[model samples]
Target: MSFAGFEDDIGGWGPPVELPTGSGDIVRDAMRKEQVIKEILAAQDDLRALLSRVNAVQGDVDKLASGNATLQTYIDNLTMQMAKRR
Candidate 1:
């Protein structure tokens, strides 16, 4: 059977590989190779998605850090004013 439809599920890295019939050894080898290629492509896609999520989390951390600094400054200013009134 042709593996043309299988490539779409694995990120569509390339065209599908056609395996020959009638030879057990040759067909087994081809199927093994195809499975390895699909695994590699799937791993690559997973890594790309993980990197994108990491970048988004980093941006959120930066925004939180900036807001914390602003709040600290405001608190310090208020504390100074209160001390002066005491």
Candidate 2:
């Protein structure tokens, strides 16, 4: 026998059985929760990317500071030589 164009199997393993109407709401709630989890994961990925960029900028700043300190030492040595010649 067939109902709604689906043949019923004697072993009760035919097409999927329909859920109760009230269960539909539960399924929707579960799907919504899954969507929220996905959004939270995406936000975490964005934060990680931002942190990586900040770290890169900090490394660049450190290099510039080191270069500046080296230049200042060279200038100080030149000033001392000029003063000795005076």
Candidate of highest lDDT: 2
Residues 1-86 of candidate 1: C-alpha lDDT, one tens digit per residue: 34865643553566775656546788787988899999999999999999999999999999999999999999999999999999
> What is candidate 2's TM-score against the reference?
0.67
Each prediction's number of clashing residue pairs: 0, 0
Assess each prediction's global lDDT (C-alpha) against the native.
0.88, 0.89
Model 1: residues with Cα > 4 Å off, grouped in runs: 1-24
lDDT of 2 by residue, 1-86 (tens): 46796655644666676766645588897988899999999999999999999999999999999999999999999999999999
Report the lDDT of model 2 for residue 39: 100
In Å, residue 69's CA in model 2 sits off its true spot by: 0.6
Residue pairs with backbone overlap in model 1: none
Per-residue error for 13 in candidate 1, Å, reads 35
- The local lDDT score (0 to 100) that residue 36 gets in candidate 2 is 95
